[model samples]
Target: MLPFAIGALRAIVEMLGLCLLGMGAMALLAGAGRQGNPVYRLFELITRAPRQLVARLLPGRERPLLAGVLCFLLLFLLWLALAAWRAALA
Candidate 1:
């Protein structure tokens, strides 16, 4: 059960990181029109929570892209840590 929970958490972290990366790519591909793109919106929706958390952490900062990048790095680190933990358990 513990390993199962760790695996689930790791999966969620990986998904969010991918969403952040996809959002960055979509933003680049669509330019200023990314807001209207359904795929971009979907990625944004999935990553909204982390962006919001980053926003709250850095009040008055208007750089959401930077926040998204930070979130991606943090999630990546977390995923790595979870993998290590699962390996130790095994």
Candidate 2:
């Protein structure tokens, strides 16, 4: 049961990290006008969940992109720690 939960969390963390990377790429290549378009909107939607989570975690920060980066780092660290622990347990 514990291993299952850890695996699930690791999967989620990986997904979030990948989404953030995609968001970053979209930000770099996509124009401001394209934000309303479907591709950009999809990236925005994927990134929004982590942004909202980050916003709640860091209330004082005004920059959402920075917060999202921090959020991705946080999840990555969690995933790494969990992987280590699971390996140690095994």
Best by TM-score: 1
Give me the displacement of residue 76 in model 1, in angstroms: 0.5
Per-residue CA lDDT of model 2 for 39-88, tens digit only, reads: 76786777687788788888676887779789889878988999998888
User: Which ten-residue region of model 2 has the weakest summed lDDT?
Assistant: 31-40
Estimated TM-score for each candidate: 0.94, 0.80
lDDT of 2 at 70: 92
What's the C-alpha lDDT at position 6 in model 1? 100
C-alpha lDDT of residue 7 in model 2:
86
| CA lDDT of every candidate | 0.90, 0.80
